[model samples]
Target: MKVEMILKELEALGSERTKKSYLQQGAHEPLFGVATGAMKPIAKKVKGNQAVAEELYATGNYDAMYLAGMIADVKAMTEADFDRWMEGAYFYMISDFIVAVSLAETEFAMEVSDRWILDGRELYGSAGYSCYCWLLGNRKDEEFDQDKLSEMLDLVKKTIHTSEDRVKYAMNLFVVTIGVSYLPLHEKAVEVAHAIGMIEISDGKGKHNLPVASVEIQKAVQKDRLGFKRRNVRC
Candidate 1:
């Protein structure tokens, strides 16, 4: 499972149509356009290779960077490593999913997420909210600082309408996560969702509409799935 071989595999798995779709979704050049389904076996083969993950991420290929996240050992990564990954995260998938998921597994999740959310950079800010969302979903209620989580809900209620586009989306997701996974905050989350209302994001030619938090929460409620905690944030 060398980086080079993995990259070749990604190249072989890539398709032009997928590349175009990725570009529409904010991916930059030097991407293989390999689908997630294709990356699974590669992740299986390279899992636990921290060195390989580092090298792959450093290469700056979208597929490789994503694969790096899949194979990375979050416990072995330092704050410095997380910072480096954040710097290289140019798109939502990389920033909000890959980097954020890894950060959620660390002790520094709250510290880093708080710092990044206030950052002026769009990607970093979005990553920050995403990290917080994943942290809320994965950790036990006892492990959470109830006061801080409540403060976060209040923050969303106050600023979600005025936050940067992607940050707003992530903030909305945070409300949904809180509503769905934290029983103590579910009602408050629904209230916050009603306050925020509709969120709209435009990517390329498409006007990407985010789910209404209240409605999503209601759907989860109907299914009797509220307050279900996730075991892990990463796929």
Candidate 2:
């Protein structure tokens, strides 16, 4: 379908309650507030269309950007294209969920993520570390460089407490993902999580403790989900 038609559909799917929730979570206007689950049928119809995805993303509507990620042709995206997407990602939901999730499906995932992490910008670093979480959760263990992941765990241990709020969340998830999905670094991730303990993060509101990664990893262990890998990164 055309971008205009898709946008109309998204607007029809939107609701005031959901829009309020999204606005509360840092989203701006020009959005339909369509839930991710609600976009699935539309995504199924237009699966992996780079041109259409670009058009949707350029609309600057939160729902459209999200739909763009779902239908984006990852293989067709270059680093420049991903960078463009990152630039348009104004909030953590778009940065981590939409951009990072889509980036995880590409060959450029690691290199681009590494650069973004080192960029030391809030949304960029969040997206970068979040990309690792997606990659580790979905890709084969053998696909990663063990040493690089080890270093990333070390980076999180060293910098998470002082990182940007969004980056801290992503970095914490990275450790949990490593502990649960990357068996080679499971022990190290547990050690790092223990050292970090509970991190307090704020999103304009007063600070609150995030979930303890060590605890999360233990839950995964109880479920016999250690070393679990997702079948896909995107919905």
Global lDDT of each candidate: 0.90, 0.94
Worst 10 residues of 2 by lDDT: 200-209
- Residue pairs that clash (backbone atoms under 3 angstroms), model 2: none
Top candidate (lDDT): 2
- Candidate 1 clashing pairs, residues 3+ apart or interchain: none
- Tens digits of per-residue lDDT, candidate 1, 1-235, equal 7778888999999999999988888889899799988899989987888999999999999999999998899899998899999999988989998999989999989899899988879889899999988888888888888888899999989988777788988999999999998888888999999998998877667777799999999999999998888887788
Highest-TM-score candidate: 2
List residue ranges in candidate 1 displaced over 4 A: 206-208
lDDT of 2 at 37: 95
Worst 10 residues of 1 by lDDT: 200-209
